[model samples]
Target: IELAEVVREVTKAENKPFKPMYDWGDRVEDKIFSVANKIYGAEAVDYTATAKKDLARIYELGFDKLPVCIAKTHKSLSDNPHLLGRPKDFLVTVREIIINSGAGFLVPLTGDIIRMPGLPAVPRATVIDIDDDGNIVGLE
Candidate 1:
């Protein structure tokens, strides 16, 4: 069966809805601060020199109104991976801001987090099948 069909058969979802955490229309910097504070329990936000420059460029480009997606550590609520659980009284230092205008969102790189682009599992070369006559099937 297909994945969706299997999911439907295995679990009965209530289709319950939850409200959005913050309004997407809010300022990009405000959104970053809000996420750092509300979700991670950060006391304050400190932007690095590079991050400040990045933010300035973003604002100058009129991208300050864009939504923000903070890249932080997954091991903890805070930026540091060592601080597990709901950490509080910590400062979130934004290292840099990456503008993805096409995707319609700004990504703020927090702490020492490295931004890794999502890649597909199957390589295109693996799909290139050949028959006994040596005719390629998926070269395109």
Candidate 2:
């Protein structure tokens, strides 16, 4: 179904917004450990040498104050994508961390993850065209 069709056919849509549940305190290391170990139920969190250096840089740059946006595979709860379902025992290995101060968040790169490209059956760009008046159309 199209976005509009799905919206129109939706039975119940809650107004409740997301609220962060777990917090291991203000430290960046604590934040990552909190997300990986506490939330994802990881037995432990292993940080790579690059990640260690990144953390040091982040702290030096004072971007460590920002919230963490952990990047991991959608295929599994753990960082390992091939783990499937909810694996009982696993480690969340943070390969590297990058900060976008303008965006105000720290992205901790975990495992081998890729961006989610939402390719639809009918691409929205295919329907987009310029009207007679030179205004864009089919954007909605």
The predictions' CA RMSDs to the true structure, in order, are: 6.7, 9.3
After the best TM-score superposition of candidate 2, give how far the Cα of residue 124 lies from its true spot, in angstroms: 15
Residue 26, model 1: lDDT of 76
Alpha carbon lDDT of each predicted model = 0.85, 0.83
Writing each residue's lDDT as its tens digit, candidate 2 over 37-94 gives 7678888888999999999999898787799999998888899878887686588999
After TM-score superposition, what is the CA distance of residue 79 in candidate 1 from its true location, in Å? 0.8
Cα error of candidate 1 at position 17, Å: 10
**Clash totals, every prediction:** 0, 0
Q: Please provide the root mean square deviation of candidate 1 (C-alpha atoms, Å).
A: 6.7
TM-score of 2: 0.65
* Top of the candidates by TM-score: 1
Which pairs of residues collide in model 2?
none
Q: Model 1, range 1-140, lDDT digits (tens) per residue?
A: 69999787656674557566677777666788888888889999999999999988998999888888888988888888999877898989899999999999899998789878667798788888998998989978
